[model samples]
Target: MRAAGAQRGRVKRARLADVDPSLIRPALAGLVPYEPGKPVEEVQRELGLERVVKLASNEGPYGPFPAALEAIERATLELNRYPDGGAYRLGQALAERYGVRFEEITVCAGADAIIGYLSLATLGPGDEAVTGWPSFPSYVLDPLKVGGTPVRVPLERGRFDLEAILAAVTPRTKLVFIAAPNNPTGTTNTRAELDAYFAAVPPHVLTVLDQAYFEYVDDPDYPDGIAEYAKAGRRVLVLRTFSKIFGLAGLRVGYGVGSEEVVTAIAKVRRAFDVASVGQEAALASLGDHGEIERRRIANREAMALLTQTIRGAGLDFAGPAVGNFLFVEVGDDAETMHGALLRKGVVVRPLGPFGAPDALRITAGTPEEIDFLSKTLSDVVPAFR
Candidate 1:
């Protein structure tokens, strides 16, 4: 048996060695892979539980809008045909909505793809991409994929330190990613703060504003991203997603709005048929259903409020002033322990260790019952960790 196991191991190693070494980028080899949230069925099977509340990923509490569903169903018959590679109709809709020219918009499989494409298009070996630490990992990994350096400025008091970000910029800085209402922490930069930061940044550097959770933001202080910067013709690419608010996470549709030149450059690196026909149709239909989207927004706000109250009542410290669909709770020292404990109970929340936030877990605002389950789970597990 020992001899047979040794031979099998040797064969595996030999097979791996036969693969092209150059195919795997050196930087990627050292990097840890992105850990996705546990799928509902997988968690259910693992825990042997009937109900599993997943408050990870910050997906919409409400599922896809009715209009989007109808559009998707209508487009399903046309699956045999290729998608509009240019995404012309979606681009036109987005352009009209944002008051930008059709040439200034670029749609992709998701915002994540757009980030990768942008990094590949604009960054090189010697270039640097500056962003806040504990922001989205894609902001750093995308840049590093193309041999670019990532300079991460740590957040100040759970918020992005605009001044520190400005100070970190140098001649080699090619790109800057500003995740307003940043992921993990769910804190946002105000319009005034952004204006000041933009003033400090040199014209040569491009800023990618990731507004995946923009629709959920109710703060008057939160910057109206496209209008505040992109419309002014600054070196900014504003990214929006149907994945979050539109409940199209399964569809993988997101868009970037920027200057015609910037959009054109990014488009050069994008793959053919980047977004599917169904996704385009769904997103386009979603655009027309303003009332339904608003209803979801209202529901999310109520859920957030309930969660916030529950967290505070439990004496847990959480990051607030969040303009997004999720909240970040500082679960003292044993965040990982709590995460595991909750997972076993069939309550999946995102641990923030990847985003450099070791003591926090990002919880998406779910339905009332789901929030109740999370609250009960935390109340039970948190004290044991303490």
Candidate 2:
């Protein structure tokens, strides 16, 4: 039996050697892939638990809009037909809503795809891309994939340090990615700060303002990042997604709006017919359902409030004044341990250890019942750790 096991290991190693070593990018050969949240079915199977509430991905607790569902159903019969390569109708819809020309918009499989395309289009072996640490991993990974150095500026007091990011830019800097109402922390920058940062950025470097959670923001002071900065003639690309607020994450639709020149350049790097027909139709339909979208925003606000109150009741420290559909809580213990415990209890939340916050967990706002389950699970598990 021992001899058989050793022979099997040798055969596996030999198979690995047969792979074309050059086909793999040197930078990505050993790099770990992004670890997404565990699927609900997988958790149920692993833990032998029937009831699982997942508040990990910052997805809409209220599912997709009714109109979007109807549109998707309508498009199902046309699956054999190819999606519009230009995404003309979706572009027109976004342009009409934002008061921009259709030529200035480009749709992608998701916002992450746009980020990768932008990095490939602008960044190179000797270039540098600047962004804040603990914002989003893609901002760093995309640049690195293109052989560009990722210059990370530490956030100040849990917020993006605009001045520091501006100071980090040099002749080698090719791109900048700023997440408005940043992920994991759920904080946003003010208009004054953005104005100052925009003014300081050189015209040669492209700036990407990510507004994935923009619709959930109710704060008047939360800088209208795209509308304000892009209109001011800055070389900025504004990225928005249907995945979050519209509840079309499964469909994978996102769009980028910017100057015609910037959009055109990024479009060159996009794969052919990348955006699917159903994704385009769903996003278009979602735009017409203003009432439903507003209700989702209200639901998110109430859920966040409940989460905040629960966190305080548990005697935990949490970052708030969030404009997004999630809150970051400091568990004051190893986040991985808490995440594991919650998983065992049929509740799943994101651990922020990968984002450099080992003591924090990013909790998405879910339905009231789901949120209650999360709170109760945490209440039971936290004290034991203490």
Q: Model 1 lDDT vs. the true structure?
A: 0.89
- What tens digits encode model 2's per-residue C-alpha lDDT throughout 1-386? 35544542353233433666788778675455677888898889777899999989888876678888899999999999999998999999889988889999989999988998889888888799999978788888888887888999998878789899989999999888898888879998888888888888898888899999989998887776667878778889999999998999988999998989878888898998989999999999998888988888888889888988877777778775777988888886677888899899998999986676778998898899998998889789889777
Q: Taking the candidates one at a time, how many backbone clashes does each contain?
A: 0, 0
lDDT of 1 by residue, 96-160 (tens): 99898999999999999999999999998979999998889999888888999999999998888
TM-score each candidate: 0.94, 0.94
Error of 2 at 313 (Å): 1.7
Error of 2 at 243 (Å): 0.7
Q: CA lDDT of 219 in candidate 1?
A: 85
